[model samples]
Target: MKNNPVNTDLPLFCPREGCVCYQSYDNKITKDGIYITKSDMVPRQMFYCHGGGHRFSETGYSELFGKHGSFKEYEQAAKLSTYGISANATADVLGRDVRTVEQWQKALGSKGQQLHYFLCLHIGINVLFLQMDELWSYFKNKSRQLWVFIALESETKFWVSFELGSRTICTACRLVKGLRRLGKWGDDHILKVTTDKSAAYKNALANIMGDIQYAYLQIVKRRVKRRLVTVKKFFVKGMAEDFSEKLRTPPLLRD
Candidate 1:
């Protein structure tokens, strides 16, 4: 791939932030498709220089650089589909073919699934609440089911995590693994993780976080009520307004 001309006066750096090359703090060039860090760790050229840690790219870089269009679009498309919008619907909004959308979705794979799940999980994690439930449904009579456990931060009303399962400990472990992979587990960042007194989550947290912190909330009506209320009051209602009309509504409201 042809690279855009590098700005020598400013100098380009590695793309990865935590990479040893960026940490070198020197004028490094791509040599033999490798970037030699200060410690002499040879990382690939692609990982070099994270657009200099500001905008992630300079003006005209989009047209002048990168292998493809923005990954942000793909992230948005995945979120839409995961949150109940069909892939075709996302394709329409993104101005891409349905198959292309599916291709992006596939390209994202587990990482994409984790990213979309973050929105769901973050909503529950920050709220100081726990709710567990087993939901059952059938698509063409083929039992499509889910076991969902949520850890909520009641104070901020944000999600800690949404651990989804196929009603098994193995899947629960997978959810925990996903959280760890996302760098959420075993971190002091989360204040309190709560879930319905499930041994699986409790055990998983214990294993990962070393008895860090948690609360066990019973499956109660008001917990869910509060969640629904938060969602409707914040996300749903906020998104429901027609921005075009709302921008025009202040004069009407005053009248």
Candidate 2:
């Protein structure tokens, strides 16, 4: 198959901040020719930051450089791995070596983490109806209990934030505090929050109310004689809003 340019013909610039090499988007940057190779003869665009004489590549900080395959190949492996395929299997399917697949996977993961940090710190998400839940599992001969606290934005269905600790109020607070950076809260912007009837969620969210402003609700499920009973909607914090009417009882997956 024919190979394309590393950055898909996008204008390349030095990612370094305060570097004049970025230019004013009008000044022409000096093309320093290809800097590296991967699989075919993938040309890496090189530019010299005239101000600092700092040179950078079109694939600077890109996940495509270190791996044996091209950026497209890395993406293909990632797509197949999503379907429960292992690195080795994806490598075989892609006709690339297994180590190359592993490198691409790690590079993809690092890129995701970097993006998440940028969003969490620089870009705040204003979410309405953030669903909170925790799943329980035991590890090491069932001696250690592992609880994963998850906060999901119902409107956009984005996994807003998460924390890992025992099902304790302290851990819940840590997760809620992280939500403050995620985005603003209001019905006009952010609205109600949903969570199963967990005392920890109530206490933690209440404590953070003075800091992050938003309405909260709880979905309490009751079972009688091992039979499914009534699912009660209860107010956990703040005055209920109009969207509360839209809150529906979700099917119980498991305890």
Candidate 3:
């Protein structure tokens, strides 16, 4: 197949933060030329920012910037890494050095974090029901225990917030505070929360969500030798009968 000509319809802007037209939609950017790299043998489009007197490529501010490899190769490595494949195994599958895969993974992870913050931070959403939980993990060795506290919106199953720390009330408070910042609820709207039988969550919700009208439930599970015996539920804040009625006919399902 023949190489396609550059499309001028793309929304290009000055990426330099100090530039006058940074992120502006004005017609201050123009195509400079095309450059071909040996690694991918593909032509990359370059542009000039007249407002900032800066020059950059199409891949500027991206994870693939200044990377010497095919885009498909980097994408495949990221996909494999997400599937729990080790960097060494990914290098063997792609016929590349393990160090290169590791570098790509780090770069991709940084870019992912930036994107996630840009999209999720302070962007409030309507959350009626939320569930809080924690997962135990370790770093380097089993002795160094770590916990991941997570809050999920029950109806949409969207991850509202998370914190990495010890399984303490401090971490739980941070998680709930983040949820408060990201959720939009009115005084009349009663936010329902469910969590395991952890006193930390109880204190956190009570402290951080005191002003908001909400219902809290704790699920207690009895286990003998890792085998479940009985399960019980307790309401800590709102009335149990009201909470159960709301659960049976959730706000989203109401006519």
Best by TM-score: 3
- Regions of model 3 farther than 4 Å from truth: 1-13, 24-36, 41-45, 121-124, 185-188, 222-229, 241-255
Residue 13 C-alpha lDDT in model 2: 49
**Candidate 3 on 1-255: residue-level lDDT in tens?**
023453335477787676788888784899999987766667888999987888888778677677666778878988998898999999999998988888889988887765555446533356777878888878779999999898877766577788999989999999998777764654567888888889999999889888878888886666687666776888887778646654632222101
Give Cα distance to truth, residue 38, candidate 3, Å.
3.9
Roughly what TM-score does model 1 have, to 2 decimal places?
0.43
How much is 165 displaced in model 1, in angstroms? 3.2
Let me know the TM-score candidate 2 reaches against the reference structure: 0.70
Q: Candidate 2: where is the Cα deviation over 4 Å?
A: 1-13, 16-36, 40-44, 62-64, 80-92, 95-100, 119-124, 136-145, 187-190, 222-230, 239-242, 251-255
Best by lDDT: 3
**Candidate 2 C-alpha error for residue 213, in Å:** 2.8
Question: CA lDDT, every prediction?
Answer: 0.43, 0.71, 0.77
- Put down candidate 2 lDDT per residue, 1-255, tens digits, no spaces: 023333324344456667665535544467777765646466767877655577777766566555667766767876877675888899888887788788888887777766776555555455767788887866555789988888887755577888888999988999988876666666365467788888888887778855555677788777877666988877766656644566666643466
lDDT of 2: 0.71
lDDT of 1 by residue, 1-255 (tens): 024553335345544445556535474544234333332233323332433432233211222132233446756866786687877888889887888777666665555455456454432222222222334434435666555544333434334445665656665566665554433432443233333334675556556645444433222122353332221111111122222231211110100
Each model's TM-score, in the order given? 0.43, 0.70, 0.75
Runs in model 1 lying further than 4 Å from the true structure: 1-13, 16-79, 92-95, 106-142, 146-152, 157-164, 177-193, 197-199, 202-210, 222-255
State the lDDT at 182 in candidate 1: 38
